[model samples]
Target: MGEAIHNVIIGNGSAGNGAAITLRERDPDCRITIITMGSLPFYNRYDLPRVFRGCYDWREILVHPLSYYDDHSITLRRNSRVTDVDARSRTITFAHNEVMHYDRLLVCAGGQGYLPEELSDYRGLMSGFGSFEAAMTTYKALPAGGTLVMLGGDMIGLDLARTLIDTGYRVVLLTNEYTFWPHRIAEDERDGFIQALGHMGIEVVDGVHPVAVEEGEAGKPARRVIFDDGGDVQGDVVMPSYGLVPTAEFMLGSGVDIERGLLVDPMLHTTDKNIWAAGDVCQIWSAEDNAYRFYYGWNNVRLMGEMAARNVTGANEAFEGLEDERLRIDKKGHIASPFWEH
Candidate 1:
């Protein structure tokens, strides 16, 4: 897989975008193609909350404009979702019915929200941070002074919750765990964040689950949410986060050991030598625990992008799972691993 002629990257999310930049920098003469599911103009999900909360403008929300990439001779296929992937012939068929051959494929198809069959009745209620469309849909439907309940109160939940609250929507987040901020903030610290946001008028309800969503009469707020704890709460909207699948369904039978995610060696190369996955798509081997780990954070995508580039360009840079110390930044400047602690 040395200097593949036609390299097409799937998914234009942060991981995919970073991979493109990384690849171009390593091998300038390489012919790179990017296939994205969303429309033109890629944005950072990390900025969604800030933007919705009146923190940043649309210009600030955009990570890279089409013109910037155009100046670099990078071709973008916006709104072109790949319908099929033929690993045997190394070809991908887009929804527009165009076939493109790839010498080597780099998968940065970041995680997508999970829509379980159990909740098939309310599957339409699920959403993720994969694209700007999701952000907009959530933003437009979120009503001012109305209650929003997050089904999964992880990183995405906390972020989106902030956005809804800041935009004048009353938010109540429900999490299995008592605290939010999966290891970035401690119990006390997380509580403090929650309290501060609560001061901003957001509520965190933990240790419970939503039994069902009682929608409004055809054109109303969610109306009511039945909880397993013999209690109920009314909501204007309910959004579920995807901490499950990383939009890696295309690689289903592509010889990739996708237990929790596409498993990769220390070099960030997937089980298939001809294909490589980065960011939320690839499950990196954790040196700390000797188990496969999937990191869906921002910095993790950046690190994996460069490493995947080095590996794809015939360079032999070993892939190291994210440096936990750097990822574990506490607001109070403590060295504790708040991202994981209960």
Candidate 2:
């Protein structure tokens, strides 16, 4: 007889979609809405590399067709960027100046590739691999048998390099302090990983710190990544892989605690009673350890979303992080990691 409960989710990635689906199933009569900045529906980011193989079909990379959301009675609002989150008012203000209210809210906005202030001058020239559009852009920029100069190394970038090399493209990864993200490579493990990458035909240049990007000479079409030491590497495309910084700037001034990321309890509930956060946008507090930690990787993120949804629907489920964090090199000098298999 009363108004139906309205549930809103920010973001349309793996964690947000996972939560939306579970929320609808648990509360069939409630109104479910998803707000995302992306133009497309849920797609596998890991599958973005398939585009390099000449598979330009976007549908092949989609995790769920657009109709899947319609069938589940979930409203998907694409291209709608949230400008602010007023926790006390329980409202979200969009970039278009539209404000909407919600009964329960979930934040799974995730993170984005960050170029530190020192590299700010080269932001415009840097290509990306974080989304479908980025992948397409990189694909279009690269010529046949072209080279990609990766400014820094990360798991996803390394994975992309592996795919690029298999397709007869060259990749030169510039070593930096933030090379391997989410996994801190020990001194003992570094040689093996670098050697494995070499075995894969990926050129690993060590101790090079890039400071700027510049256009090539009059006859050359390549871009140059200028090092701090005046040396440089030329490539068809340059991508910065310094890892992701949590996309939680909009949550600022909302009274929700944020340190590196949104602070949430083990149940994914923020300090605000009506809101919950999951995925890369949040740091979970560990009572036993007395520290807040971030759990990266797809398996952990997907589980976080499902658990957050259940907790939102009157269930008490604590997220126990997944165990896909190990990285190792095989006898054949091949790098193996559960993180890249995604």
Candidate of highest TM-score: 2
- The weakest ten consecutive residues by lDDT in model 2 span 333-342
Give TM per candidate. 0.83, 0.97
Which regions in candidate 1 have their CA more than 4 angstroms from the true location? 1-4, 54-60, 115-117, 125-130, 177-201, 217-221, 242-244, 324-342
Name the 10 consecutive residues with the lowest summed lDDT in model 1. 333-342
Give the clashing residue pairs of candidate 2, or none: none
lDDT of 1 by residue, 190-282 (tens): 555555545545576766667776676665566566777878776777776535466777677766778767888778888777788888777
Residue 101 in model 1: lDDT: 89
Best by lDDT: 2
lDDT of 2: 0.88
lDDT string, candidate 2, 151-194, tens digits: 77788788888899999999999977667777878888888788
